[model samples]
Every structure is written in C-alpha cells, then in structure tokens.
Target chain A: MSRESIVNAALFALLIAVPLGALATDEPFIITLATRAVILALAAVGLNIALGIGGLVSLGHAAYFGIGGYAMGILAFHAQSYTPLFEGPFVIEGTKLMPIIWLVAICGGALAAFVIGLLSLRTTGVYFIMITLAFGQMFYFFTISWPAYGGEDGLSIYVRNSFPGLNTLVPIQFYAVCFVLLCAVLWFNARLARAPFGLALNAARQVPHRVEAIGLDPVRLKLVALVISGAVTGLAGALFADLNRFVSPTMFSWQMSGELMVFIILGGTGRLFGPVAGAMLFVLLEYLLGGISDYWLAFLGALLLLVVLYGRGGLVGIFAGKARNHD
Target chain B: MTEPVLSTHALTKRFGALVANEAVSLDLRPGEVHALIGPNGAGKSTLVGQICGAIKPDEGRVQFLGRDVTEQSTRTRARSGLGRTFQISALAMEDSVLQNVVLGAMGAAGTVWHFLRPAMKDLTIRQKAEQALERVGLSDLASLRTGEISHGQRRRLEVAVALTLSPKAFVMDEPMAGLGAEGTRELTALLDELRQEAPILLVEHDMDVVFSLADRITVLNYGRVIATGSTAEIRSDPEVRRAYLGEES
Candidate 1:
C-alpha cells in the first residue's frame, strides 16, 4: 500500500480507538466529543465533493445542515406531541425512526441543493461564494422569524431518536452508528473519486472547456456534485441534532458553513480522509485551546493562513504525501 | 460529389459595432485536409467558434453531417462528432495523460454518468484511450501527468483527445504552433494519417506544412473568404498574394 493508504488506515484506527478508550474510561463527554468530530467530518466530506473534486467553493452548505437538523427536530417533535404534521394532505405523521429521518434529511437537503444549485451555479468564483453566503443568511433569518417550530430559541427533543437493536442513549452505541455511517460515506466518496463521473468532474474542475469539447456539460456535472454533497452534509446535520438533542437556526448560520470548509482545508482539500483529519484536529484544538482563551479562532486563522501559504495540501499532505495520480 | 462532413453557410458574427465574421462559408469533404489560413485579426478563430458551436452567429447556420446545429450546445455538437482542438492547448493539466484521453473516450461513449465502476479499469474506455494515444505516438507518456509533458506532446495529446470522439471531421486551430522543426514534421505526418479517419479543417500559420497537406485552401481576410482554390491556384492569385502571402513570403 502507498503512504497515503497507510495514513488513511491509521487515521481510521485512531478514530475508532479514541472513542472506545473513552468508553472504557467512563468518559462519556469524551465519547460525545468524538461523535461530534465524526459528524462534523461527515459534513465536511460532503462539502469536499463539491469544493475539492468539483472545485466549487460553496458557502451555503449550512442551509442543508439546518434543513437536516430541523428535519429531525420537527418530525420527532410531532411524534412526541401526537399531532399530525399537517391536518390535511393525507395526514403525514412524524416518526422518530432514525432510518426514516435519515431518508427525509437526505431528500430535503438534495431537493434544496438542486434549487439552490440551479440559481447559484450561474455565477462562479467570488460571485458564486457571495450568492451561496446570501442563501445561507436567507435560511438563517427565515428559521428565526418563522416561529412555528420554536424559531430563534430553537427546539429540543427530550430523548434521543431510536435506532433498532441498540440503545442510542448510550454514548458508545451512538458513536458507533455515526462511525459506521461515516465509513459508508467515505467508501462512497472513494468510489466516486475513481468512477467515470468523478473523472469528468475532476477534469471539469481543472478545465471546463476541455470537458465541454470532449462532450460533457460542466455545469451539469457540478450540479450533480453539489446535490450529492448537500445530501451527505444533511445526514451529518441530522446526527448532530440528535447528538445534542437540540436544533437551532444557528445551524444555518454562515459561520457553520465556514467551519465545514475549515475541516476540509485543514486536513487536505481532495484527500479521502482529509475531512476526518481536519475535523479531529479542529475538535482537539477546541478542547485543548478553548480553555486557554476566548479567542482560539484567531489562532486557527493564523494556522489556516500558514496552510494556505506554505503547507499547500494540509495535515494529510504533511503527514502522508502529495496525492499521486489523483489518489 | 461526396457530401461535405461539415459546413457553414453565410456565417456572420458581430461584437456591437464591429463584425468579426460576415458571410463566411466553408466545407470539409471526406478524406481531405481543407486548410484555413489568414493573417492576424482576420476572424478565423471567430468563424471557427461559430462552426464549433462556441460562438453564436448573428446570422448563419452550422451544419454537421447535414444537420443544422446552429442552436446546439458546444458539447452536443462535439458529441455529434464535430471534434476540435484549441489554438492554445486546453487539456486537464492535473490528470495523468491516460486519464485525460480516457476522459475523452468516456465523453465519446456517453458514459460519463456511470458512477460506480472505476473509470480507469473499464476495459472498453481504457482500450479506446490507449488506441488514441498509440495513434498519436503518446502511449509511452500515458502514465505521466499532462502538465509535466513537453509542449509537442500536449499538442499530440490534444489530437488524441479529439480522436477518441471517433470524429467525422476535425477543426484544428494551429496544431503546429510552438512545435520545433522535428515536432512539426512528426505532427504533420500524424495529421496526414488522421485525415483517412476523418476529414480535417486545419487552421495554421506554417505555410510549408499547409501547402504540403492541404487538398483545398480557403483564405480568410477580415472574416471574408478572400480566396478558395488548390495550392497552384492560391499561389497564383494576386488578391491572395497582396492580402496575405505578400507580407510573409
């Protein structure tokens, strides 16, 4: 195996070992922190598909993330209250089933992404970034003002959602679910990176006209990438809401969108486990440095500058190697 | 007469007040190199853009294999076998040479949407890309990143990409540009062979290569066809001599 493969393997091992060790030591909070890292990494992985492979720098991903969080909150809220989601329209009932919530979250995120992508993709570079940020802010204000599902104060579920054959209330059990989902998404991302769709998307990112001259529509490719990315990030949002037993308009804030991008940049933009490494590092720094000062983000900004200037690739690039042959 | 593989009729394009191309018509017949030569600011690229569906004409129609494709997207025309190479090499610099060719093969096969199977391992796409690379004498450089390759190799790689389309006609924009004498000689020979696979509409500044390879010559001056003839006829035409060849020769 190549050095990158070895590093990826080791990273996965460390991710698993940390949580399991936390479980043994009865550090439920540490396990919760690990779960947060996994979910954030999962969200970053979604952004990586568009930002890394497709070369789209979207700044509105929190809209999808918030949609997912609200998807979980609304459904479980209705299920707990014994009220139909709507009086008419075939009497849609809210259910706390994890799989169903996940399905709803994915579809919600994907549908929103399709509509947003259609409009945002018309502009590119800095304009595209501004448009996405605008969309994110739009969602943030809408959620705060709506007031139907707790609005700005946010909604909270008294108990975590249910998963069959496991008590999700247990920190280790919940972490396992998020871990497995992260692994599956990572595997899917890896497969996509090698697939024909990925090859065209990568080429489109580098030279769109070259892709067009060879008979592929670059915009369509990017739209699909954005949709997939949104769906994955949405799933992570659902898990994040469940982990905290809370959902908020803050989930849709622009800062959350920027944080997801940070995870990818810190790890390595296009590397398979770059999001994972970046997320873990971000969490580790938060845990370690959040105690030291209220301005930990200033340090992060400095580090991000260093990565942008000299590091070129990020943590994975430093530890493993530059990706050879688009690996 | 054999039907022309590609043609444009009364193609005109305007940028506000200035007209880039006006009433320009051209055709490439089967198994022939139809060379388009003109001096700078002559609107050859503009006319080419119209034919390749990159530029929309204010007035005109582009027909490929007899179908009017004036409104088709650039990719649709490309997929319909209107292969083109850029004047400047437009290639995926980050992709390996094989991956770049494979991308073209994937485009030609219309299998770019296939999401599960690894693209490089797909035998059909791999073989087509390999065959195109072999045709351009670039099989040995297939594994190298495209950016790291020499200028001449990138030019040939461009031809390889177009070839994977299984083109009915080629719209080449200065395929000989930036090549050394030996590189130019090699590409000239390869392009001569490529005509047997598909007719070529060549745009070039190299008069010797143009004269040697062109079965027919169309000269453009200010977006208008100044002359259309064989090597002997164009060589003797006073208008062509005064407009273009006089300054260079």
Candidate 2:
C-alpha cells in the first residue's frame, strides 16, 4: 500500500471514529459538527472534478449548490403543507422521500451546470473563473428577488425528511447517511480521475493545444465534467439544507463558492480525499476556535496563509509528503 | 501529385503589417518525407500552422484526404487523419509516459468519454499505446512520469504519440530542436523508418538531417516558397544559395 492510501484510510477511520466517540459520550453536537464536515466535503468533492482534475476554477458552483438546497426545501415545504408544487395545467406534487429529492437535486444541478458550462467553457484561465463567478452572482440575486418561497427570508422545513429504513432526524443516523454518500462520491471522483476521459481532461487542462491535436474537444470534455461536478455538489446541497432544515439565497453566494474551493485547496488539490481532510480541519477549527474569539476567521486566514506559503500539498501533503497524481 | 494526402493551395496569412506566410502552397506525398527548411521567421511555422488548422490562412484552401479542410477546427483536422507534434513538447507531465501516448491515441479510438472504466484496464488502448512506445524505444519507461524523462526522450515520446493516431500525414514542427548530437542521429533514424508508415511534413533548421532524410525539400524565405525539388536539385540551386543556404557548407 502507498503512503498516501494509508493516510487516506487513516482519515476515513478518524472521521468515522470521532462521531462514534461523540455518540457514546452523548455529545450530539459533535456528531452534528462531523455531519457538517462530511456534507461540505461532499460539495468540495464535486468541485474537485472540475477544479482539481480538469483545472476549471469555477466560481459559480454555489448556483448549483443553492439549486440543490432549494430543491429539498421547496419539496419538503410543499409536501408538509399539502400544497401542490405546480397548479392549473397539470398537478405536480411535492415529495418528502430522500431518494426522490436526491434525483430532483441531481437533475437540477445537471441542468444548471450544462447551461452554464456551455458558455463558460468557451473562455479559460481567469476569464473562465470570472464568468462562472458572474453566473453564481446572477443566481444569488435572482433567488433573493424571487419572493415566492420566502426568497430573501429563506424557507424552513419543520422536520428533516425521511430516508428509507432510517430516521434522518437522529443526529447519528443523519451523519451515517452523509458519511456513506461522501465515500461513494469520493470513490466516483477517484474512478473518474483515472479513467480515459479523466486523462484527456487533465491533459486539456495543462495543454489544450495538445488535446486538440489529439482530436479531443477540450471544451466538451470540460462541459461534461462541469455537469458531473454540479450534480455531486447539488446532492450535497440538498443534504446541507436537510441538516439545517433551512434553505436561503446565502446558498448561492460567492462566499459559498469560495468556501467550497477553500476545502479542496486546504486538503490538497487533485488528491482523492483532499476535500474531506480539508473540510474536517476547517470545521474543527471553526468549532474549536469559535469558542476562543469572535475574530476566529483572522486566525483561520493566517493558517491558510501558512499552508499556502509552506505546504505544497495542503494538509495531506504535510502528512503524505507530496504524492503526485494520487487522484 | 497523385492527389497528395495533404495540400495547401495559395495559403496566405498576414498579421497586420507582417506577412507571416504569403501565397504558400505545398504537398506531402505518401511514404515520403518532405522537409520544409528556412531561416528563422521565414513563415515555416505559419505554413505548418495553416496546415494543422491552428491558424486561419487569410486566403487559401487546405485539403486533407482530398477534402477541403481550410475551415476545420484543429480537432476536426486531427480526427480526419492529421497528426501534429509541437515545436515545444506539449505533454501532460504528471501523467505516465504510457498515459501520454494513450491520450495521443484517444481520438482515433473514439473512447475519450468512457468514464467508469480505468483507461489502463482497456487492453486495446493500453496495448496500442504500448506498441507506439515500443516503436520509439520508450516501452521500458512507459510507467514513468513524462517529466522524469530526458529532453531527447520526450521528443521521441512526441513521435510515439503521433504514431498512435495512425495519421495519414504528419505535421512535425522542429521535432529535433534542442537535442544532442546523439539524440538527433537517433531521431533521424526513427523518422526515416517513420516515413514508411506515413508521409511527413517536417519543418526544421537542421540542414544535414534535411539533406540526409528528406526525399523532397522545399525552401521558404520571407513568407514565400523559393524552390521545391529533389535534394540534389535544391543543393545546387543558385537562388536558394543566395537567399537562405549561403551560410552553410
């Protein structure tokens, strides 16, 4: 086994063990915190498909994330109120089932990513980043102005929706759901990075001319990656909304996009489990440090500076010693 | 001309005040190496660019496989059986040498979108890439990262990459630039064998390699073709001697 793989395994075990220990001690807040880390990490995993592997620095992923959150919030809200989602021409019923909500969130993410990626992939480097950022802002303001579903005030679910054979209301049960999904998405991202498509996509990121000469359309490949990326982030967004039982335009904010990127960078760019490690560190610091000072973010910024300046591979690099192409 | 596999007709390109390539027309016949030699800034790169669909010719037509490709995208040109190597190496440095060659073969195999299965697991692609690597004597280094290879090895790897396409015609820009004497000799020999597989349009500054390997030579100066003929004829052309080859022995 490679050192990186061992570190990855250790990370997985540690994340799982922490919540279990918290569960034993009856510190349910710790379990909730762990669940937040998993959900945020899952969202970053989605971004890594484009940001890390494809070298697409998307600043609008929060649009898809927000869309996912809204899907969950709107559906559960209507289902609880016994109100139809659509009226007049055809009856569209809302659903409280986890699987159905997941499907909806994925589709919403896929659609948004497809449209946005189509236009954004035409430009590259800083232009691509800014274009995506602009699209994200567009969604942010659109959501705030769309007043029907609480708009700027946001929508709240009275209770967490049910998953088959599981009471999602239980903190530990919810954490398990998020944990399993995180593992599945991480596996999927890893599989993709090693696939033929992934090889071409990575090549495109480095040298687009070479990719073109090889007869592959770099833009098309990136578009597909963006859609796949958005789908995963969207699913995480839905889970996030369920965690808080609330959805807001804040989900679409550029700050949310930056934070998603932060998770990937903090762990290590392009590493399979980088986002997960980054999220754990991020959430832990936020929790442990929030207790110390109101200006906790100042310390967090300094830590990020230390990592960027000295650590080449983020947190994982510090532990695994800069394993290349591990993803 | 037997309808040369690749042909440019009256291709003209200008960058504002500079005429990078002017009314340049050329052809590459099957199983022959046609070397394009010129001084720096003589429009050899521009002409190569026009042929490979990298730069749009202001006025002209390019045909590949007997079909007009003047307006085709670079990827489209490549898909239509054109292979290209950069003047500078354009490789995915982090990927294995085998992976780089596999990427070179991606367009021909029509499997660039297969997401679930690992590319290395695809026996067909893996073997094809390996065969190309073997031809270039880099098979032993297949699993090594491209960045770990020497400069000369990377040049050979570029040829190995082009081979995977099974290209009908090759557009190689300065394939031998920056190689040592030994590296140049090895590449010359490989390119000699390579022409039997597919015709090559080789652009270079190395006259010895050009004279030894090229079946036909074309001389370009200041965006225009000055002469095109067999190696012997080009060697004695007074106008060519005066214009570009005056410095060489």
Best by lDDT: 1
Q: Considering only chain A, what is the TM-score of each predicted structure?
A: 0.98, 0.98
Cα lDDT of model 2 by residue, B114-186, tens digit: 8888878888887898899999999889888889999999999998888899999999999999998999999
Kindly report which residue pairs in candidate 2 clash with one another: none
* lDDT per residue as tens, model 1, A1-327: 888999899999998899989888899999999999999999999999999999999999999999999999999999988888988658899999999999999999999999999999999999999999999999999999999899899999998999999999999999999999999999999999999999999999999998999899999999999999999999999999999999999999999999999999999999999999999999999998898998999998998889878877888998887888752
DockQ of each: 0.80, 0.73
Off by over 4 Å in 1: none
> Distance (Å) between predicted and true CA of B210, model 2?
0.7
Clashes per model (N, Cα, C within 3 A): 0, 0
Residue B192 of model 2, lDDT score: 94
Write down the DockQ of candidate 1. 0.80
**Model 1 pairs whose backbones collide:** none
Compare the candidates by TM-score and give the number of the best one. 1
